[model samples]
Target: MKSGVHRKLLNYFLGEDKTMKKFTLSLAFLLLCLSYLPLWAGDYRAAYEKNDFKTAFALAKPLADKGDPEAQHMLSGLYKVGWGVIKDYQLARKWMTKAASQGHKEAQSSLG
Candidate 1:
């Protein structure tokens, strides 16, 4: 048996466990949280649907800056159509290409 702790933990993500198990659980939770943190905000698309471009922009811009391709795609649309912003094809193209480089599908289609 591997007898060393290849596990880790944090205080905020505590769950039921013994000391070592608690550590491992907390670490796992932390990793999970970190992994999904870039997209943590739900209802972003929902906000867009409600024509709340300001809300959508607010929700998507930071993630877009963080290299989230989907957010980039959304930002491209916001720029293209002037949703909560001034319309600028150049800016739209810029954001679309940024997203396309990150494998965003809609960005590629828009580029076509």
Candidate 2:
């Protein structure tokens, strides 16, 4: 009778161990995929397209500050249109010029 109880406990523990391992592996895989997400400047374009201006501005500002020309161009428009931020044409032109200097075609044409 004692041996049967021991066997049951052993099986229970083994089953729990397997479940724990699967959970850990799934969590790890999810984190790995999240870590591999691209940091492209245009990544925030979806937010802008959705008219989620606050989210777009929040995402673009950091990339623009980090010297991303595409982000600079987008940020320029955000400033010009007062989307999720105060209107400031001077700031818009400043950011546009920065993007244009980096060979952003749209910014260059807009500047002209």
For every candidate, C-alpha RMSD to the true structure in Å: 6.7, 7.3
For model 2, the superposed segments whose C-alpha errors exceed 4 Å read: 1-35, 39-42
Count of clashes, each model: 0, 0
lDDT of 2 at 15: 80
**Model 1 accuracy (lDDT, Cα):** 0.81
Candidate 2 colliding pairs: none
- What overall lDDT, based on C-alpha atoms, would model 2 receive against the true structure? 0.89
For TM-score, the strongest prediction is 2
Give me the candidate number with maximum lDDT. 2
lDDT of candidate 1 over 1-112, digit per residue (tens): 2332223233233543367676777999999999996456655677899999999989888888888888889889998889988898898888899999988887898788
Question: What TM-score number comes out for model 1?
Answer: 0.64
Candidate 1 local lDDT, residue 35: 92
